[model samples]
Structure formats: C-alpha cells, structure tokens
Target: MTRKLNLLLATGLTSLMLLSPAFAENMLRVSYPEDPKSADAQMTTDFYTLPLNIFDRLVESETTGPGQSALVPGLAERWDVSDDGLTYTFHLRKDVKFHNGAVLTADDVVYTFDRMLNPATKALNTDILTFIAGAEERLDGKADSVSGLKALDDQTVQITLTKPYAAFLALLAAPGASIYNRAFTEAAGDQFGLTPETTNGTGPFILRDYTLNDSEMLEANDDYWRGRPKLDRLLIRVVSDPDTLRMLFESDEIDVFDMDFAPTQTPYFYGADQWKDHIVSGPRVGIYYYNINQLKKPFDDPRVRKAFQMSIDRQTILDKNFYGKGKLEDGVMPRGLRCYAPAEPIAYDPVKAKELLTEAGYPDGVEINLQQVSSWSSRWSDMNQIIQAQVAEAGFKAKIITTDEAAYLAARKAGDSDAYTQVWSADFNDPDNFFYTFFSETGSKTRGYNNNDPEVFAAIEKARGMTDPAERCKLYQDLTARIVDTDAAWVPLFSLDHSFVVQPRVKHFIVPWNGWSDMSYYNVEVE
Candidate 1:
C-alpha cells in the first residue's frame, strides 16, 4: 500500500468511529470482485459472500486444512440422529440472538426452512432439502409445510428425512440454509436484502452501512454469541478491474484481496517480494467442466457424446489453459475428499475419436457449437477457443460462441445450447453432491444437463441409501465410473487452488475448502 493511502486510512478510522465511540479499534479493509446482488440468503446461490458471514447456519464447515473442512455446530449447539438415520434433532442455543436482539429459537429454524421450501418464495438452491420428508410435497404446493420438520419446543427442531441420507448435516451447513429473523424478513417485504438497513442476521458482524457500486462497511456485533470480533470493523469495497485491484493492493489502499486474481497476474504477484509474503494458495472444492446439452441433435446421442469425450486431450488443456495452477480431476470428487478414488483419465486419441464418430454414423464429421462467458477475466472464452480447435482435430466441426454472463447462464439452464463451459463448487463434504447433483434425476433442475439414463439413475439412488460404508464406497465408485468413464456425460476438467494475496498486517486467517473461507469467525487482526 502507498504511504498516502496509509495516512488517509489512519485519519478516517478515528473519524468514522466517531458515530460509535465503542468501535475505534482494529480495522480490516478488503477489495471485493463484485457487489452482492441480494440480502436474502436463500434467494441467490453462492454468489453472495456477505450472507455466509452475516447470517449463521444451523451448522458451519470449519476449515481444517487446505481444501478440507469439518462440520461443526453453529446456531444449533448440539444435534443427534436416531439409529434409523432418518430422524435428526437439534438442540438450539438459548444464548444466541439475532442482530435485532430477537432470541434465536426453534420456531425461527422451522420458519426458515418453510419459507425456503414454499413454492411461492422461489428459493434458488432448495435442492439441498430434497431428502426431507414431504419436501417434494411442500415444494409442489400440495402441502403448506414440510411434514418432516417440527418444533418440539422452544429450543429444539426435529427433522425426518424420506430415507437415510448421510450428508443431511453437510447440506444444512450450506450458506443458503442459514437461519434468519422471520419477523424482520416479513417486515422488509420485497426489499429485504437490497440494503444494509433491512438486513438483520445472527452472525459475528452487523451490516454497518452500504453504498451501491462503491463499498460496504461492517461493524462487530458487540453482543455476538461468539464474543466480539477480533477486528472492530471490516470495510469491503469493489474493484472489478484486475489492473485497478492490483494497483490498490500495491498502493497499500487495501488490506487483502481474496478473490482469485487473473492467471497471468497470479504468477507475477507470487514472485514479487513486496506482495509475495501475503500470498495464500490452497486447494478448493470446485471443478471447471464443460456441460453437454443432450437437447441438441449430436449431443443427444450416446455414441456422439462418447466420441466427443474420448477425443479431448485433458493434459495439454490443464497445462495450457490453467497454467498448471490446479490438479487433474478424472471424476466428480476432487483429490482431497474421503470418497475420492483417482483413476487415469481417458487418453487423448484422435484416431479412436474418428472411428467412434464413424460408428455413430457421423463419418464425415458433425457441426457443434460451444458457448462461454463474454468476459476474458476468468479466461473462459480462451478455454472455449482452445477446446474448439482440439475437438476439430477429430472430425468434429466446433463453433465458439460468446455472450454476457447472465445470458449464457440462462441459455444453459434452458437447455438451449449445444455445450457450455461450467463450474460447480462443493456444497458439502459428501460424494452425493457430485453424483446426485450432476448425474441423478434428483438434481434435474440444479444440473441443467441431460441425465435420463435409467441405469445411472438406479446406481445414484441406491448409493444414497447405502448405510454401510463399504457398500456406499463401492456404489459411489461405480457411479463415478459410470458418469465419467462409461457414460461420458460431462467432460471432466481440472480443479483449481484458490490463490489470494493478503496484506502483511493481516494475521491468522484460514482458507476454507469451499470458496472464500468463512471469514465470519476468523481472528482477523490488522497491525
């Protein structure tokens, strides 16, 4: 950071805290990639980072090691599951309270899930709650509430699933599953998460203030259940331009920028002495793959899909596309997960690819289109062009198309595109997130891919209910092989390690296995 910016921050710290005499201590400023779109946690997917820190969930994933997290209690102090594995009862903490001073209760938990499951609410990631008994019924508007969820008393919430699901706790730990104040939400109406004033959560920090397209400030909640935060205040500002973000970090205007810097920028930042000490790189639970749309003619045929999958040279792409910053992923799960069983990916063979295409009745090669984001920030467009050439080598005519991020997502979700580059981050620690999310009928809306095969569906469903670890392991492995090797539904790609640059003053911040470690409860002290 520059000397001028350092002096300015020191002066503003005192002036800003004048409004609240109690908050004139430690301050941490960060440069964020984009502004949050919504305040309601369940309405959006993983795009909103504030909700992860502002609103506490029933359970939270505590970072253990790089690319590793363990499920721990959050609002619910303790929980127990019945021997049948279908019933789960949570004991809520009586001492916890929302930022509004309302006591956290079992009723709030019930209300949160009910609101998310309501057909009218149009929650974005309600697929996580599909295992809860009567969830389907409630979502279908056949019932007003989820029959499986009940408040036994003021401090307890019991949930019964349709069957034994091992990852139920992990699913509850997701950000979208965080608890909120029902009274406050209803009062905020349609404008709940639009501004800081309308958002009330039960987390470590309070929404101090917000300035659209500029920055937002957060003050430590003095009455927080986890005690006061180490830092008195957190100032998050937007610096979307990569060059501008790099300059701010260099000028000492920002303390840390956790968002992944551009691929080219990452190497330069790591090698520079003034910035090298602040670098933190760790494995993340995310995969960037190409989603195939079977709604199209050639992609609809299993033979065509297999032919396309068999032709790709994954090694060259990983080394060239990502600059060797990630690991080769052959299956759904990454290298760190327990269910992970790595196998050699299919070798790239253009000759074999052509033979398969000929057998599939496309002897003269077929025309297919590829889609990607219009932005070059993440290098999605460049990756698309690279693959377009690689596939064209094996009797496939590939056309590269670009559109804005939102339009590209909408087109993919509508199954209107032939193929599109996509990314999926782990919501929990289970293999079910990979198998159920991408390949099962259970995740039809969430995946937006073609997965109507009956055998694959049976394998996924059977794996979900397998109580024995040995059996579950066997089934998960089988399902992974079917999806990646045999079925070739998705073109498996590389998994990346999130790279970040922190200021030297920042201390004791750990990275989460998932994207953006839970900064909510970290001991962030700025010198």
Candidate 2:
C-alpha cells in the first residue's frame, strides 16, 4: 500500500482509539503549554516540529557536546569539505523521494536555498545562511543568484562560503534548513499551514490531520529516506493551561508532559508513593531574563543599567518563584558551556540603586513600564512581579503590564515595548549563538538598542572571524565580560531547569541540549 493510504488508516485507528482506551495506550500523547503559531514547514518556530514529524535536516548532533555526528541520512548520504574550508560537496542518497513521490534532486536543494535567501520570503532565520557567498547580496536584491550555491549534477550539491564557520554544519541541522517539496508548497497556497492533512516533505513521518486549537496527528512514513519510524501513530495535544496539563499527566491521559510544575507544589505530587516512578529532570537550553531598551532614556546610561541590575534580588526571586529549581546567572552564557566566566553577581542594594538613579538625573524616582505575556510559564509571571516590587523599593517605580501571548510577541518583535521578559535558547551550542543574536549590533535589537560602539562591534567581528575553537573561546570570554560589566545591555536572571516525565516503556529517548528530543527513534512496548 502507498504511504498516503497507510496514513489514512492510521488516522482512522487514532480516532477509534480516542473512543476506546485500549488502542489509546499505543499512541504517544504529548502536551505543551504553547501551540505552534504555524506548521507550514518553512514559516514556524522549532516548537512546531515537536509534534509534526514531517521534516528532517542535513545532519544531527550527538548529546555528548557541541560535536555533531550523522544521524538519519536525509538527502545527503555523505559530505566532504574542501581543504581550504570554502566549499562543501554533498553526495545525494539514491532512491530517496518526497512524500508526493517526487525523486530527490540537487535542483530541489538549490531551490530551497534560493527561497530561504529571498527577502520576499521574510524567513526569520536568514542570518544563518548569510555566510554563503553572495547570500547577503541576494537577500538585499543586489544579486540575481547566490554565488555560493550550485547543483553539480542531479545527485550532487555544492556550497561555497566566503570564510570558514565552525558551526556551519550544525546550523544546517536546524529546522530552517529542512528541505521542502517546491511543487507541493506552491500548490497548497497560503492555506498550507492551516490545512490538516498535507504531504510535502521527505521526513520519517507525514502529517495525517491537524487542528489549530485541538490536536495534531502523524503517522510513520514507510518510504522515509532512512527508514520507517518504530511508532505507528503520534498525537500532539495542545493544552494552554498548566493546571489542566498537570491533571492530564497525573491521570495518565498524556504520555509526555513538557513543563514541570512549580517546585513548591512538586512535593504534593511526587511525594506520593504512587507518583515517585513518573518524575524526571533535565537541564534546559534557554536562559530566562529581562531586556532593557538600551536606546531608551534612563536605560541608555550604563550606570542606570547597572543600578537596575543591582536592585533586583535574583536569588530571592528564584527561591520564591522557582522554588530554587534553577541557577542564578552572573554572566550571559549558561554554566554548561566552557566560555562561561565566573563573576560575582550584583548584590541587592537599594541605597546604591538610589544613588545611581540620582546620578542618572532621576533623584525622586524613575517610573518604568514592564510588560510580559500572561500565558507564559507561571514562574516567569511570578518572577516579573517580584522584580517589580523589589525595584520600587530601590527608588524606581515599575508598573507591570500583562497581555495575551499573541499581543506580547507582536509588541516585542515590533520593538515598540519599553521593557519585557524574554528567553534565548542556543541555536548551535555556541556562546556566540546566544550573545550575538541579542547583544551584537548586527543582531536582532528588537528594542531598538543597537550596540553601535566601535570597540564592541570589533570584538564581535574578531570572534566571528576566528576559526580555531580555543581562540574563539578566549575572544567570546572577553566579549562576555565586557558586554555584561560595561554595556549592561540586559540583566542576567537565571538559567532554568526544564523537567519532564516519560513512560518507562519508551526507548531511545534522549533530551537534546536545546530541550527538543527527536522522537523518530522512540518506541513503546509492553514491559
């Protein structure tokens, strides 16, 4: 039978399982607090891929470290880099085809890169591809084509770069680089992500059905480039409320739970003998913090920024809000990475904060508006409120504003907000990946705070140019201390620890450094 027909049968079986509890046991029911804004393969964040199994990338990393080893062979069977480190040649695997039964070709790879580099597409991750020769020119509409990309043959692809980027291979492993069937995407039109049952990619699974506010269903692609997935069906349920998710997991209605409950409440659940076997904890890949618009008044001065940072009690907030479930961050880089520098965390001193505010020309008090998303994890909201109260005591009146998720993200992206809460996850297991995106001048200065300082920009360029890992590490270490100690672009908060629970019967399940697990290898069997 064709893969399409098999997917239909699996959908039918899943619907039946929803009515009967027996077959439901075979389905891997997972729940997340926030749903993907889009699943059009090319237009969504990485969170969308957690449920939809219809996409794969060039290579994958081992959980060991920044080093990457090959996993499921997608379009490329094997690849080699030129000795000068300017060219990469990939040998396409034979007999691989898209879900629509179209044979894979180098033309598709070229087309994919072209679409991604096009400014009209407005892909969020265009920066990752900027290293390609002429990519920046193409993106700026100055070049007719990307000079670095070429199709040597129907089964061969070649890419040329202006300089060597050590993390280039890892960048290809991201979802932004996932290959798509051009014809399928074009035919689906604007309703592609909104459509439920769509087949367009060459991954291990196909999207069988999807509901915006309800659930998404996937079935193993028997004709997958590597091989069929072990699981027959996958169900991703969207539950926005954390309390409801907790109840669902406690009742065994869902096999996977993404966020851990508040630490103060953990004892009530796991303390019970019945729940002891269901708990698991792991390190989170993101840092939770607040960003002050460095371009705006009051915060524009480094002394004001340092004063603000000293006013908040990070440890107290972590203790009360997170129940000491996370670590206080003195530097921007998370402690797990080698480039992290151990600096003394600014102590809470209301007097020192008042004196700095006075020096910044705010003698009486400075009033600031703080905005946050209401639907974010409860710990975040609580932490914001704590800071608001604490900062007021230090001669700054902070007013808290909360909005729905959609409005919050829209305002943040538009760079119209004064102060807001945000998180940064490592894109490629590099400190540059974290700091460059937020602190650097060329990075996303969503708050209109561009680090136009010549010296700082020079340091960033130096770090980017160095290909040696050890030399790069030193450059980043110095850059981190300078940015945190001098510029005060953002106030470091805490490195969160995301916790989850999995069924013991599931196998080959590893939590990636970025908090995403590739579920293609996961299997469920009777113990």
Candidate 3:
C-alpha cells in the first residue's frame, strides 16, 4: 500500500472507532447515497444495502454463468419444479442457523412470504411473489394464508403458482423473498424488522448497529450457513453528494464505492491514468425513461404523448447529463439482455412535435407539468431542464416541478403528474421486468398512469410462462413494440453504463449490473 493510503486509513479508522467501538481493524468501510426506507424489509423502497446483508433468500445468485445472475443454493439446499411447472418443492439445508441462534425451518419461509403477500403489510415489492397461487387472494384478504404455500415438513416447503413463470426462481433471488426466523418476527408483531433489534436472518452478516440516515454497521456472522464472512464488520455511511464520495476515496477513508460519478467528475474517472486499475464499469441491463400520465388531458391524447416523445433529443440529453456514457434505445428494454433486439430510434423532430400538437386539436400547443425527484445526484432533474427548453420549441409550455423522493412517488402513484422521470433496474435480468413491470395489469395500475389494455396484459403473461427461448423472445419483441410504439406507455431514453471504484486492498468485490447482491459483499475482504 502507498504510504499516503496507510496513514489515511489509520487516522480515519481511529476516529471511526471512537464512535463505533465494535468496529475492528478487519472492518470494511463504504458509502451509500440513500437510506433504507423501512427496516420492516417489506415496505422499503430505497435500496440501502442492509436487507441484502441481513436477509437470506431461498435461492441465491452467483454471477458465474450467462445473464445477470445464475441461481444457486442459499437457504434451500435443493429445489424441484413440477413437470407441469405449477409446483415448486424445496429441500432446506440442515444445520442452517439464523443470526439469533435459532435453527431455520420451512415454517419461517412460509411466514415470511405470507407477511409479504398480506395487503396489511403493504410491502412495495410483493409483485415479485404475486405468481404464487392464492397470493392475490391473500393480499386482497380473501384468504388467511396463501393456499399454494404449504410447509410439508420442518425441512420441506411446497409452492404452487397460478401458472408457469420461468422467472419465478430469479424473483426469489431478490431480498424481498428472504427467509426469516418465525419466532423472532412474530414476537415483534408489526414492529418486526423496523430496527436492528427486531431483525434476524440467515445471512453472512448480522446487524450490529444502525444510526438511521447517518450510518449503519454489520458485524460478520460466525455461524453463517455458507461460511463465516471474511470481514469483521462492514460500515455503510450515507454521503449524498457525489463529490464527497471522491473526497473520501482520495483520502482512503472508504475502500469501495459504486456509480457515484457526477457529470463533472466523469473526466477524472475516465481520463485519470493513475487510478486506471481501480475503476470498473459495465453496461447495465436497465432503462431510464419518462412516465407519461395518459389520464391527463394533453397526454390523454396519444398524439400529444408521441409529440412529447419526439420533442426532446435523447442523444443530446445523454451527452449533457451523462457525457455519452449510456446507450440509446427506442424500445423500452435495454440492449445487453439475451432477448433484446434493436428498434428504430425515434426521430428528434421539433417540427413533427408541433405538427402532432396541431393535428391533436392543440394548434396553440399544450401546457403540461413535468416532474422529477429532487436530488443533486440524480440526472433526471438535469435532463428535465433540457426537456423543458426543447419542448418549448415545439409549442408546449413545459412547467418543471421538483420534489423530494416521497412526494414524487406519491404523485406518481396517485396518477397526478402529467409526466415524471422514472428508472427501472433489472431485478433478475429479464425482459419480463421491462414489459411486465411497467406495462402489465399489476405494473401499470401501480403507476400514476396505467395501461388497462387486456390484450397487452395477456401477451405479457403468456410470454412469461413460455419455456422455449425462441418463442419467448418473439413474444417479448412483440410486447416491446406494443409498449413503445402501439401503447406508448413509456418514452424510451438511454441505458446507463455505471462506474465502481475498489481500492487495491478490497478483494472479491464484483459490482452486479443491478448494483446489489446477496453474496458479493459477503465474499469481499480487505487485503
């Protein structure tokens, strides 16, 4: 290590120790820009990286194979799907232990899913499990327990889905599908998982301390099912400013950080010769686009919505906000996924936008409010400014409104915004997350502007159940056209390429495309 880095690490950690006395020399320090929305694990919208460390999913993902992730044994030692594809029986691993020293059982897994699917819990991501039979009924209060979810024994669990879904296992890999200790959670009641005290899981790390929005600490689990984690503890410090991330990295205070590069700092990261080996970047299978409220007047007309789409030059916005670091697309799905195919890019024509507005009975053009989450770290606000200017040339009065994340989300959910900037991160890397999440009945209704077209919803559902790769890809391609061209549910924009920094001492740290993983940090060690 450089003499500079050594001295900085020693000094920074010395001060950290004063605050968190449990932090040992083997601890790994890092920074995040947001806080976990809920400790309940069910209600959180923000990905603060605590739940993935605190909870263990049924099937884990290892990035050893193709696509975003390949499923591997996690809490479940082995699992089987029925010949007809409706039933899934999992054999739990014996000797697995939760953080609180209780042995994990099938009942705990059953309890966790029941709690998540219950409408009373109001978990934000329960759509991941709506495929399980009786899920909707359970969520709708028609059933006390998911009829499809039954614990056959202490070490065996069976799940029956309403239909075949190829992505079901992949969905299980997300943190929302985690297995928890039943005894601990039930005793905690509605307060379960709201604090460090009420949470217990079968993960490699145990929650040691959390200071709300400021900082959180996780100590290594000695009895972790896979094995003991390498580091003694891991610290997640919330530093919202991208500039502060670089400052801390330069001072050697934080060993690792990801995707915190600001537009101005893009040069230092891509141009710097000294830190060449320290940087890692990849094209993520994700999409960022505009969510237009079709229920609104101007947007209610498909022509006006199409005009809004063509007015702003996506290429220019990519250049200005992200420095040409992202790939442009006309279709809603991104490029890197196995099933992706390119579509004709929407022409950047202000003249056509004006013509469309006139044809739609708005010769004087239309006025609409655009919404974006207020965050200096977000490029949406920056892009909205350019959009407002570009749309003005097309005879539209674009009023820009900025709000905190919560209010923005409420507006979107209430279908109150004419248009709002939205981003989609591939939870398990598939076109299903693209088409089904935003365009289908479940996905669309959740948004402020929803598409209730029965044909489109049925197509997405059918494609998800198809097993043949060729057939599935064809269905997805057709669905993509329905979304971007026919339905115009979302205005296609650019897919991001992200940058992650790992100091020379950090080992086995791989940044997944979606930016979060269950075992990635568990394997990381400070050399």
Candidate 4:
C-alpha cells in the first residue's frame, strides 16, 4: 500500500469511475481520461486510437523498432506515382469489405474524399487534404466533386495534386484520411459516427456498444482485410480521476495505463521496482511550447519576444514538473524525425532577459497573461506556476489563467490569448508537418499565431514542392533557425516521452514516436 496514498495530489484531481468488475482473458482493458467525442475520424479531433482500429487509410505508419516507423500500404495494396510526382494511382485490394458487408472499391475511395471535402460535411481537420488538386473547389461549393479524384475502375483510384507535395503520401497515412463506407455513412446521414451502428469502417475491429462518457466495447472483425485482431474484444473505459485510475490498474481492472494523466506521480510509478518490466517509454515526436501571439502588443517586438524566451528556465520546468521525463529541444522540429538537427541550447540568464526588456522600452517590468488548461495535463498547473516565478526574476509578471478545454481551444483559434501553452504531435514523420502546418500564413490563421512573415511563408511554400530531399531539409533548417532562434516566435520547451504502464497478461504492444496514430491494435495479443 506504499504506492497507494502517496500518489494523491491535492489540486488538479481528475474524475474517473470504473464500473466493470472483471474482464475476459481474451479482452484488452484500457482507460482514457476523456471519452472520445465521436467515432468518426474527420468529424472530430478526438483521440485516434478508437477510430484507427475501426477504419483503414490508404497507407499507414508501421512501427519497425522503438521510436521508429515507416510508411506501408493499408487499404491500397500497391500504388504508382507519375514521373512528375503530382499524380498517384492506388490499386485497392478486392478482398477488403466494410463492417456492413459492402465491398471496398474505387467508388468508396472517391466517395470518402468527396464527402470529406464537401462543404456540408464540415469536417474538422480537412486541412491535411488541402493540397489535393480540386479540394478548394469542392470545399467552396464551386464543384460537386473533387476534380483531382477519379475512379479509373472498380479497383483503381487516381488522385492528382495542384502542386507536387513531397509529403502527400504521408498525409494520406494520417488518421484524418481514414476511408469510410459510403453506404453506411449516407444511410446514417447526420447521425454518422455518433453511435455504434453508424461507426462502420473496414478496420480490424467493429464497435459493438458505446455508452457516452462511460465505456466502449469493440469486437474482432472476422471479415477484416487484415487478419482478425488477436484479442476478442477491446474495452476502453473512461476513467477521469487519477487516483481512481491508479486503483483500477492496481486492482487489475485495466491492462494498460498512461502516466500522463497523473504526471506528478509518474516518477514514483516509473521507479516502482514491482512495475519495472511493465513500463514502456519513448521520446515523443512533438514539441510542447508557449506560443506568443505576435500580433499582441509587447510580444510583437522581436526584442520583447526574445527577452520572454530567455526569461524562463526550461530545464527547471522539465526537471521539476516532469521529473526529468523529457528532453530539452531548441527548434520547432522534434527529435526522431527526418531533418532533425540539434541546435545550440538557449541558456537561462535572467539578468540578460531583464536587459533586453529594458532595451524594448519596459525599464521597470511587464505583466503577461499565461493561459493553460488543467484538463489536458495535471502538471500544467504546477508548470505554469514555476514559469510565473522564474519569469518574475526577469521583470515579467505572469497572470495564470486556467480554463476548460473547449474555451481554451476557441480562444487559441481566435488569437485571444496573449501567451498560451500548446503542444503539437506529428501526424506524419515529416518536417513539413511541423513547419509548414504551423508557420505558414494560411495554416497559422486556423491554429492561431498570427505570424504573417512573407519570407517564411515563401520558403515553406517552396520547400513543399522540392523533389530533392537534401535541398528541402536545408531550407527547413534555415526557416527553423529564423523563426525559433532569431525571431523567437515561440518559447520552445521540451518534448515529453510517451510513457505507458502495462499489465503482465498483455504480450506485445508498441506506440510510434508520435505516440497517438496507428496504434496497431490488431497486433495486440492478450493471454
């Protein structure tokens, strides 16, 4: 019982209740802090673990080793690219069938893209598919269907791009590109993905039951294109409280638990001798940083932004808040991705930060509204407080504002926050996923951060079309240096490690470097 009460923290307590007393031996039990808003991939930005298992994409990221993955075929058995790199022809597998017994064909492929791009669908993350040649026309109600998408035959689909995008395939491999059965989706109409019956896809599992904010039960699909999942069923329970989640794991009610929900106790659970072999940890391919709204007054000045960046001790935040669970990173692009180059570390010097602030016309001091959300991570409350005191030494007063997830996201998109906490995990293993998606003027508009530098925008736009890998990476490196080092667009912090604690009954499991997409639930074998 030494590990029991010692785990409880006073503030930031989550609410999780596990009602199931026991599970079958052939079942895999897991817990999520928040219930998935919907089973539809494109409709909501809910965690992909549920939808990825229920749906298949044109391609997928296959984990080859620890913290490494390569793009492999999923629904498409084979594909060929034109010499110009703008056209892709995918040959679908004839054996694939949806949960409702509809055959997967070229029509389904075309319908999938058409529905997502349709102005009425109002898909949440269609930005990933923006490069498709006629996506704009379809999304704007100018065209009935995407001109780029064409069904050559029952089993053949061809897609053209407006420009040559080197990361196009990787983009298809993302969760948002998941293929849906046109028949099932159309029949359900507005109710698609909201209930179990409408959440049909061709993935390895089929949803049997889903109780809102309680639990979801999925059964192995024998008709799955890939072999049936080894486990008979997947029981995903929503446990909101850290203490209750820990008690459930200790009582063997859950097979796997993510330490992120209870960050303060991560070191204790990780160091517990009894749970040593059950722990799995890897460097996440992402960055956790404080984005400063450049359009905001004081932050608009480069000197002021640089001073804010130099004010806080990032290492201290990593050490105290995370208990040394993450690695300090300087640039926007995280480690474990292609074109990763470790830059010189930004040293912590409060005196120099104060000097920069004085030069920027704030001789006495300045106050900044630091916004965060407790729902995301319990440690953000502690992390923000530490940052508040650290920056105070450099003549910056921090006003901590905590809000719910919905309000925080709305505020961030509207550029309502002066400075806010944000994290970006890679959807695909490409620098374009990081730089172009966040820094470009067009892309930044939706994600907040009103950086409209034409030079950065032009450089990113040029790099997207470069066929040469070396040249593209060099350009990305230059852009990263300018945004992060010179202009201090964001106070880049560290990337946390994806840490999960597993039970002995589970035989094998692995998450990609990014930690969320393509969990490979089909490969999970329970004893």
Best by TM-score: 4
Candidate rank order under TM-score = 4, 1, 3, 2
Superposing all C-alpha atoms, what RMSD in Å does each candidate have to the true structure?
A: 4.6, 4.3, 5.0, 6.7
Per-model TM against the reference? 0.86, 0.82, 0.84, 0.89
Q: Over 4 Å off in model 3, which ranges?
A: 1-15, 18-25, 35-40, 64-67, 118-124, 140-143, 194-197, 261-264, 294-307, 336-338, 350-369, 372-379, 392-416, 441-454, 487-489, 515-519
Clashes of each: 5, 0, 2, 6
Candidate 3, residue 240: lDDT: 79
Query: Which residue pairs overlap in candidate 2's backbone?
Result: none
Q: Compared with the true structure, what per-residue lDDT tens digits does model 3 show for residues 24-97?
A: 35778887777664555577655737777888888976665322556788889899999888999999999898
State the C-alpha lDDT per candidate. 0.77, 0.69, 0.77, 0.81
Worst 10 residues of 2 by lDDT: 518-527
The TM-score, computed over Cα atoms with residue i paired to residue i, of candidate 4 is: 0.89
| Cα-based lDDT at residue 499, candidate 1 | 78
Tens digits of per-residue lDDT for model 1, 1-527: 22332344445453343223233236677766677767688888745567876889999877788887788999999999999889999999987889989998898999889889999889987988988999999999999999999999999999999999887888898888989888988888778877776999998887766667777667778888988888777777777887888877677677776646445687677678877777887887877787877777787777788778777777788788666778877787776564777855766788889888898899999999887676745577778778888898788899887778778667656656558776777777788877887788745434567767789888888877777877887788777787767677777787888877887778876666785433453467776
Expressed as tens digits, the lDDT of each residue in 475-503 for candidate 4 is 88888888887778867899888788888
Whole-model lDDT, candidate 3?
0.77
Better of 2 and 3 by TM-score: 3
lDDT of 2: 0.69
Which segments of model 4 are wrong by more than 4 Å? Answer: 1-23, 358-381, 399-416, 443-452, 515-518
Best by lDDT: 4
Q: Candidate 1 at residue 10, lDDT?
A: 43
